[model samples]
Each structure stands twice: as structure tokens, then as C-alpha cells.
Target: MRQAPSERGIDPHLHRDITELIEGLEFEHQEQERATAEVSWYKEHTLFFSLV
Candidate 1:
């Protein structure tokens, strides 16, 4: 059986996995920001229209 790395070095598989996870998290963060901005805009418009 092949043993996995057990020392302080870059493993290709691990590096790839971590990179993918970071990218996924960044994409999710951007989506969340967009949704938040949309909601904020809607709320502001709704409030302004209600007062008019």
C-alpha cells in the first residue's frame, strides 16, 4: 500500500483539493455579496416609494 505524505511538504492532491475549496468559498462569498446588495437596493427603493 502506498503511504500518504506525513511531513511538511506540498502534496499535489492535497494542494489541488485546497485550491478548489478556496475557489469555491470565494465564489460563494461573491454570490452572497451580490444577493446582499440586491436586497439592500430593494429595501431602499421600497422605503422611498412607500414615503412618496
Candidate 2:
């Protein structure tokens, strides 16, 4: 019987899968950067105030 997609076997779908993985990682990185920038902006604009 033939093995089903062994680790040593060549897959025709590998290229598409790798491309998708890379794109997903890049998208996540962009989102992280945007979140970090927003947090930094909020921190910079914050001021300490005391009320009596």
C-alpha cells in the first residue's frame, strides 16, 4: 500500500500552503505594530492630575 503524504514525500500543495502561512504571519505582524503604536500614543498623551 502507498503511504499517505509521508514527511519525505513531495507534495504538490506545499507551495500554496507555504505562501498562505507567510501571508498570515505578515498580516499578524502588521496588526501587532498598529496596536503597539496606538498604545504608545495613548501613553504619550496621558497626564497626571490631582483633584481636591
Candidate 3:
């Protein structure tokens, strides 16, 4: 039931791999969020201009 390097019987390499994977996933998520925000902003502006 142990997880992470600080836990008992955890391998250092495994911990490093897991850390890297988590970081990569977090970076990807941030990028996706930024892209979504940009798209939303563009859509809002486009709609506002079309109505003007």
C-alpha cells in the first residue's frame, strides 16, 4: 500500500520515473488549459465583433 520514495521499500528509480511522468502530465494539462482559454477568448471576441 506504500507509494512514493519516502514510503517504505520504494525504489529510487521507480520514484524518479513516476515523478517525471506526473510532471509531464501536469505540463500537458497546463498547455491544454491555455489553449482552451485562448480559443474561448477568440470565440467571445469574434461574436462581439459580429454583433457590433
Q: After superposition, which runs of candidate 3 have C-alpha atoms over 4 Å from their true positions?
A: 1-7, 40-52
CA lDDT of every candidate: 0.66, 0.66, 0.65
Quote each prediction's TM-score: 0.58, 0.51, 0.58
Task: Report the C-alpha lDDT of model 2 over 1-52, residue by residue, as the tens digit.
Answer: 6667775576659968988889977976666666668765544335434353
Residue pairs clashing in model 3 are none
Model 1 lDDT, full chain set: 0.66
Higher-ranked by TM-score: 1 or 2:
1
RMSD of 3: 11.5
lDDT of 1 at 44: 25
Assess the local accuracy of residue 40 in candidate 1 as a C-alpha lDDT between 0 and 100. 56
* Candidate 2 clashing pairs, residues 3+ apart or interchain: none
Give one digit per residue, the lDDT tens place, for model 1 in 1-52.
7656675578889899999999977976666666668765543224221121
- Please give the TM-score that candidate 3 achieves against the real structure: 0.58
Global local distance difference test of model 3: 0.65
